[model samples]
Target chain A: MSFDVDIEVRRGDRTISCAFKSPRGITVLFGPSGAGKTSVLEALAGIVKPERGHIAVAGRTLFDADQGIDLAPEKRGCGYVFQDSRLFPHRSVRANLLYGWRLQPAERRLIAPELAIGFLGIGHLLDRMPRSLSGGEAQRVAIGRALLSGPQFILMDEPLASLDASRRAEILTLIERIRDELGLPIAYVSHERGEVDRLADTIVPIGLPD
Target chain B: MILSEVEWQIVALSLKVSAVAIFGALPISFVLAWVLARKHFAGKVLLDALVHLPLVVPPVVTGWLLLIVFGNNGPAGRWLEQTFGLQFMFRWTGAALAAAIMALPLMVRAMRLSIEAVDRKLEIAARTLGAGPWRTFFEITLPLAFPGVLAGMVLGFARSIGEFGATITFVSNIPGETRTLPLAIYAALQMPGNEADATRLAVVSVVLSLLALIVSETLARRSMRERGGHVL
Candidate 1:
């Protein structure tokens, strides 16, 4: 599915604007810590309402402030992996992964839960509680949960920030596999240059403001 | 060794009043806790103060206030009595209302802490995953706050079971009707040479309070474990 964004949002004292479209593959929002990368991703996902401009995924208008058509986050058909994983600590990994699927319309595509469990290499973690998962494991489960949502676009904000170097390497490779195999349009937010170089297909640098 | 018929009646009546008070206040307390923890509105401080009014006010004053608004001739009382054919004046219902008011502050405090403790990011994630506002509240927020809700209920139950001053003031000490454990003990202590009866009732109250505390703690721990959260 195609993903397009032309949005301006206020970040603290700054007014940041961005416009881009990705037909397929990963589009990395590469920048420094305070460079408004997460804000852009949040706006696209409908988590943060844009000050102006519009967002459309697969030609479906998700937001247009002028038109007064701002779809709620749930109806945007976007998957988001929060910086902290945000796994439902009360649910098992399997349950967390199945949560989004449970909310889908009955006529939606029937993607098996096992595919996500296997894709993220979290088969063994299905019954494990979120508290039992290590940082890397939790991140993997977060990715799996997002994927199981049948999203047209996936937004991940520093999904590997909590991991060690070796763990980051493992998750990075897995992300590349998800990109090549699933071909889902992905927007990744990160301050680390090394991660961007390793995983990003289209590096959308957070350019200096005028 | 055996509870006399009068003692049994008093015990049953106290339990019934406490149960009704706790059950009645639960939903309103939960909504108030969410509002206090998450929302900011005009006169929020005033609303917060009103919720904790029972805590700082003398129980006698609280009872007097309840009587003013909820007594038979009062506005709310008149409306209720006219529209619903219900009465709260100097009855067991009045005792339950008094207990609920006395226990409300503690319930709100416990629940507010729990609701605040929830990681808001999780709710955001749920939103992105296609759960609407009410659905996210029930599925995610409520389950995560289960431990806190349980604490609030236990605190309310304990507070209600021991409600005295407000209950007496609102409903008076009608044996087997408005008389709860605390009121019963107070009544016994005032009568001529009824020290033994007072002590027995006081021991029962203590035992009941201790049991509720233990149960609350146990359930809190269990909820934490079930959710894979670390006990703090």
Candidate 2:
């Protein structure tokens, strides 16, 4: 299995529990709004700490409460594409895409920047500020940025949730390409039935399955 | 030509004192502001209150405290002088130090608000993309909070320009060395025939404060515009 995760995270008064193991390709955390699906992605990215249990990805133990092992977010080698496209508003698209790429050591750089930029098709939009881009363009740039981060795995939190039908289809195709071509393990968060049906290699229901 | 050389010297010294004070206080204020804005630890309340002591207590009390700590024979004063040949007693640098301390609370408050206003989610995103804490702060948090930082500088500079009680008590009003605009104004007022001189210095002080605010606001707006038009 590429991912073996059984974690309980506390959010306010409510506690969210999730357990899943997935083989390579996309593992979809399917659920409705406020189901704590996004929280799962954050935990995988090491941005949110799980209260208990363990997180093992790609033969590496990221977190194990019993073993007293917890890694920092930056050391986890994750490319997290946030739902809002969280591009640095102060930087150009080119700089945002290269922010992590430049930080990775030459030997650690797994994906070439040119290839990721070509795959995401954000070449023409490179010089533009994030605020000026359309939602779809921003997301594509965000995806490109994540891909070029030289990460071991990618966690996407509902990247298509805010897109139009056409844009959604486009990003869906992009996600499929990333899974099949890049061969990178993906933990994708989504509440869409059609999306899960179309893209999930392994479905981990976050809440009651609809 | 219109003002005497001594009056001009006072204006220049006032500017120099405020400039040094703002520059000296900025990094410390930023670090304190970031911690206050982001961290939760034991004694945080005490730290916050201590930081604002200059703002709440009477200026004369603050001045007396500075004198006690930074006086020639005080522990800190002796050690600094022994270690680095640094002297703060009865000098312009001592006046600058007093102004900086008096300005620190306002500077920290403005910067803390700005840092708090930064989207924490973006910082998280930056971390997930392989940035360490320092890298993320410099690359993302600082740039986004630049406008607030500028505003804080102006607020601190304006306060430093008007610093009187603390500067007078800590450094003493030595002409050409420690006397600033407000001190010059007071000196002129002490003499019966020098109302015109005091008025000129007071007018200059007002103009300087106004200029600092206008320049700070313009720079802040420009920075915000450059970062995509979300003016603070």
Candidate 3:
């Protein structure tokens, strides 16, 4: 699916602007810290509102400042995997994965819970609480949760930045596997050159506002 | 240790009043606490102060206000009596109303603190998962804040049982009707040569309060354990 993004967002005192189209594949937003990478992802997920612009993914308009049409995050159909896995501490891993899946309408559901759990290789940890999982395990569950929500595309904000080297390697391989196997378009945010080289099919560079 | 019928009646009446008050006020308290904790609007400060007004104001004054609003000739009382034939004056229901109003601040305070303590990120996550705002609150916010809710209920129950000044002022000290434990204790103390009866009732109150506290703590701990041992 193609993604079109042309937006200007004001954060604090700075206005960050970007206009780009991403062809189906992994499009990495590469930038240094404080360069509004996360902000862009947040805006796409409808978590943050842009001062001006329109976002259309797969030819469906998610936000349009001119038209006063801004869907809430839940209606955006864009899965988001945060850097820190924000799993509900009260729920088991399986429950967390199903949290989004169960809320989806029958006609809108594209991914099954079993498929997501199997794809992420987290079936064994289904009953375990989020706090008991390691960083890698937790991230895997977070990804599975987002996937099971039947998103049109996925936005991952430096999802590997918090893991150790070995865990990072594991997650990196999983991300590539997800991209190749699922064939889902991904808008990834990262600063690591190695990660970009290994995963990015298109690169959108962001810089600090002058 | 055979207790007189009057003592038994007081204990039963106190329990009934407190139970009714706490349970009846629970839904209202939850909504008020959630609004106080999550929503920001005009007159928010005024609403908050009004909710907590009973906590700071003397109980007698609160009871007096209730009487003014709910008395036979009062506007609300007269309306209710005419429309539904409902009467709160000189009745157990009136005592329960007084207890509920008096306990509301404690209930709201506990639930609000708990609701505030819940991580907003979880709610956001729920939203992303397709849960609407109301569903998110019931499934995520309410369960996470369960411990606080339980504690709040216990505190309200304790306060309701001990409410005397308001109950007396609004409903009067009618035997078998409005004379809850605290009011009974006061009566016992007032009557000459009833020191023993007063001491017995006070002991019962202390015991009930302690039991409520113990139950509250136990429930809180169990809820924490169920939620993966995270402390509130």
Against the hidden reference, what TM-scores do the models get? 0.96, 0.93, 0.95
- Model 3, B110-164: lDDT tens per residue? 9999989998878877777777788988889888888899899999999998898
Quote the positional error of residue A105 for candidate 2 in Å: 2.9
* 1 or 2, greater by TM-score: 1
Off by over 4 Å in 2: A208-210, B73-75, B78-85, B229-232
Best-matching candidate per TM-score:
1
**Interface RMSD (Å), each candidate?**
1.1, 1.2, 1.5
True contacts kept of each: 0.98, 0.92, 0.67
Between prediction 1 and prediction 3, which has the larger DockQ? Answer: 1
lDDT of 3: 0.89
TM-score of chain B of each: 0.96, 0.95, 0.95
For model 2 chain A, the run of ten residues with the poorest summed lDDT: A201-210
Instruction: Identify the superior model by lDDT, candidate 1 or candidate 3.
Output: 3
What digit string (tens of lDDT, one per residue) describes model 2 on residues B1-232?
2778888999999999999999999999999999999999999999999999999899999888888898999888888889999889999989999999999999999899889989888888899889999999888998888888888999999999999999999999999999999998898899899998888888899999999989988888788878852323
Clashing pairs in 2: none
Q: Would you list the rank order by lDDT, best first?
A: 2, 3, 1
| Model 3 Cα lDDT, one tens digit per residue, A81-158 | 998898998899988988888888878777678887777789999999999999899999999999888788889999
- Residue-level error in angstroms, candidate 3, position A84: 1.8
Ranking by DockQ: 1, 2, 3
